[model samples]
Target chain A: MSETGDGSLSPARPSRGMFGVSGSSDTSGFNGLATPVHADLSTPKPYGSWYDEATDHLAEVFGGFGDAIERIVVDRGELTLHVKREHILELCRTMRDDPSLRFELLSSVSGVDYIDSPRRLHAVYHLTSMTYRRRLRLEVATTVEDPHIPSVVSVYPTADWHEREAWDFFGIVFDGHPALTRIQMPDDWIGHPQRKDYPLGGIDVEYKGAHVPPPDERRSYA
Target chain B: MTTTDTPGTGASPTDPFAPSRDTTEGRIFTLVGGDWDSLTDEAISGTEKMVVNMGPQHPSTHGVLRLVLELEGETVTECRLVIGYLHTGIEKSTEYRNWVQGVTFVTRMDYLAPLYNETAYCLAVEKLLGITDDIPERATVIRVLVMELQRIASHLVWLATGGLELGAMGMMLYGWREREVILEILELITGLRMNHAYVRPGGVIQDLPPGAVDKIREFLVYMPKKIKENEGLLAGNPIWAARNKNVGVIDASGCVALGVTGPLLRAAGLPWDLRKQEPYCGYETYEFDVPTRENGDCWARFEVRVAEMRESLKIIEQCLGKLRPGPVMIGDKKIAWPAQLALGSDGMGNSLDHIRNIMGTSMEALIHHFKLVTEGFRVPAGQVYVPIESPRGEMGYHVVSDGGTRPYRVHVRDPSFVNLQAVPAMTEGSMISDVIAAVASVDPVMGGVDR
Candidate 1:
């Protein structure tokens, strides 16, 4: 554990706000407001109707690799699996191939940059199984310095462009992606635009020669 | 331009062909000459190929979309679509504005189906606020009605544009003519012909204007006859059939693998409509059929879209019948919009009564108005992805709020962006002319694609 410079000991694990910008006071009248950290919660047995059976079947299938899964969260009637970055491809393959867990369609692949966390770049995948009329979300996170995850394009060819987009926006490297060049941005464009620290690049609005500053520099609301 | 003809002139300035070079296989030659068959033969074989760039400005392309094609004579060997020409950073812009104002930004994403974009984003924000179940019943019915009308309008544009691209110029007129009636209705309610930010987080911007239901009833009656007229114009015509049938074919498995949805998926014989699969906005209570076709071709997509308009008509009629007088917005004043936004002679503004009360009645009322308008309401810290069936396909908004007035991050999983990826899979190995049909069938609104 490390000291947070205020005589308070930080959590042993990498908690939220570990990497956020320090010393900047919030101007939204919430100056010392504490955002509740989303701690991993383990659901008790019989975790809803199909959620239990699905987890049990997954446990049976990935018997030895069950440790790679960090947490299983059931929130707002949706199931999400926090998987270790290294085992995402294997889990996706199993999820797609297994008849009982036939998540045949990759609904979307997007990246969320949680700059406050140690593992800042979160790659979110939404999988839909038309046969079973079910959907599941799989999430994997990696640090800014070493953000690499195996590409799932082999299992779902539709992930090819999405991986490129994730790479283009959040700078999360998808290893083994066939030509993972920038998809949305220009090939020569600078820095990943979607990261929290990246500037919004909004130009000042000049209406009738009156100047208005950009959104970030406007009246602070945190 | 001057043309010179000379044979075996290695150094002659008039030579029309580049100097031929010897290879292990044979002589590799660049045909700058006027011979057509030799060039076609060489291109057809593995010896040579041509690369062509289609419009970021082409008329047939729905908007600013560019495609790089590798051509082997007239057959397309490969097709690569380059999007993002119209990227406006709507998702990035939402972080700067409050939750209620986000509707104005997202409504511009899919300009043809602006209501769906607004509805989807509002639903996600509502879900994040944990007020999904608290939306008023009247508001839900209005949402259904407005969404169905937008669907018909969007499908009309597709039909008109698709017909014009396939050389039926008259469809452009008929489709736009029928669509104008719906736009009039939308204008009557939302006060904008396009990009109406009518759908809000708690409810719609306002309740239905007087006689709005009767106008919609008139449109419901008038639209079916026009749809039949459109079918009559193209359904039995051999030229249209030849241009569409069996072209741009992708089976159900291919569509699933490529993550294609909406009519393109339905055309491939999959009845996977989000309205039925995962109902939102009280869609489960509405009676309608998810139209599907056997073949996933340009023709099948056309048929599915047309059939969907009829089904939308059915849903609209049901909505009109179910239109009971009730409040359109939620009762929670803290989260609900403070004023009934109305269009005046100048532009949109707070109604006169609201302005008078806030300014003259009480100081507390004035303070409440200022706080709600400036800082907006704060949402609890959380993340949610709400998916809805839009005109094109499944439109999902992944919104994250860090318990603040402004959103932390908002990512729209726009159907156009995801569905546009299937262009290459649909166009490759088809004729050059078929590319138009294929792209039109997918109906990728570049505004949504690039956003």
Candidate 2:
């Protein structure tokens, strides 16, 4: 938290003095700032809004592999498409190329493990489309035994590090990643830390005459 | 630190570890039984490359970000970024906290812009409970106001640090000066500056405090001039422009492929702002334009951010105008408790004016207070994902409940972590100097990245 000579955080302000608006006073806009806009929550939610239609359209694009699509959940203005592990890359490719539903951007790729689910591992892809200004959530489910799915790196290069992260944390392997090494965790780390079944603590490092139990052995404060 | 200028310092039988022509070119008798003279060409002629370890403690990194750089004559051949040194496993920790208490945790994750984190988490929980409508009008407006203010503060840090990275020390100073105004506003309203848990699940922690309106008014007066002064210093300067312009250019297609968003996506000639495309917190009600540009360079990103700051100011002004006195939190006593007044000279729970009625007459008031605090509200068993236009990009929270007070699982899609994926794509093949410019453009807050 070092300070500059003028007592500002950063020495230069790039956009300064170009705009004619006087920075000295808060008079003009603040005085006439418009009334608060009330949100209309009472309107009946359309049974199949445009978002739902888009999801269905994406599903149709993967016709032969339609069985891979498990469930479509639309909540909080986001669409989540749950798919099987084997068909994730294909689904992502289709979603990206489809003109009607161009989910070109894979905004985020992270892994989650539902301890209770039969297929415990899930690689969640948060996709966005620049053209349509719409978002779609693509999820692929796998088991801890073989957490392999074809990489979407060909479709979206950004998936390289994201896939590496998934591989590192949940042990979900992406097949076609050029260099699918660990991104956050160390290179030779043993266990997938984010998985629900995995313990938080490292090995049995004894501390103060007591052998330290694995993370799961720790008590839950709640 | 003796210089081993002597060509061959008496090599022993165990000195096969010595650098030699055998090691460099493998042209000589590369025998295991070679003497010291056989390795003379190998040791001195071998290219000297320096390796610098930049942190897990470096100040410029913002957090415990460690970089191992292989430098050959000031040119980096390879760079390895190491993180998780700041990892608190907040996502895993989220599973054990209740929906209401979860706001406090998420807010701390993106320490710079805590409001966005709180808003995203609450929106997800509200969606799961199907209580989006239950969020009061005043609450939504207040949420929007605070979030936009947080955006300005967050961007100020980005501008300051980005300038600092490029050796423009003055920019860093002005940036913090402006950010302090936002912090003061936060403290006045929420009782804390950085990690204010004001925006909660059902509503805010409480209503806006006394004199919050005037403080915000004063800040609005002070900020614009400072922003203008900052722009004057760096925006059009020949050196700054040369250093940033076209230094790290990534087009729309490239940006899309890398999953980059926010100013980076917009600078790449895509006008995909979440507030414009998918309006949250009643952003649709405000009249503000999505700032976009054609040049996908460091300079373009900086320009877009400057324009965005103006838009945010417009939105903030609008919120103030509509700041008609009303309840900040929802009226559901089941979720929010009644504001209690202080007692008189004789210490007691109730004020002297209403002491008789609270103790003797109103058992319902006592019961309501007790119920509201002890067993917090319960959210139904379900999952919901909510996205908000954070300063970084589309920040979202995916929360799951299992018919209990605590959430079954809570995961945050922090924009910094997500946006960091595009860094190498933006930096590869470009001059190593452009790496700093490109990274500064993405504006990553590493807490969010590591979390």
DockQ of each: 0.25, 0.14
Over all chains combined, what TM-score does candidate 2 have? 0.79
TM-score of chain A of 2: 0.68
Best candidate (score: TM-score): 1
Which residue runs of candidate 2 sit more than 4 Å off their true CA positions? Answer: A1-47, A51-60, A73-78, A186-190, A198-222, B1-52, B70-72, B337-375
Per-model lDDT: 0.83, 0.72
lDDT per residue (tens digit) for residues A1-222 in model 1:
001111011132233231232355543423433343334454445557588899889988975456878877665556778899888898999999999999999988889887777788989999998989888889899998998999999888889888888999999999988889998888898888888778776557789999899876888864
- Model 2: per-residue lDDT, tens digit, B1-451? 1123243454332345433342453223224444445444543555655567877786667777676666655566666677777777777666554457677788888898899998999888777655678778888989988999988998899899999988889899999999998998988777788888788776776667678888888888888898888888998678889889987788888777766778888988888888988888888999998899999999999999988988899899999887776666666665554444353576424455455555677897555554444434555444556778899988877776544445656767778876766666666555667677777888878888877
DockQ value of candidate 1: 0.25
By summed lDDT, the worst window of 10 consecutive residues in model 2 chain B runs over: B1-10
Count clashing residue pairs in model 1: 0
Residue B90 lDDT, candidate 2, scale 0-100: 75
Fnat of model 1, as a fraction: 0.31
Output the number of the lDDT-best candidate.
Answer: 1
Candidate 2 is graded, for docking, as incorrect
User: iRMSD per model?
Assistant: 7.4, 18.7
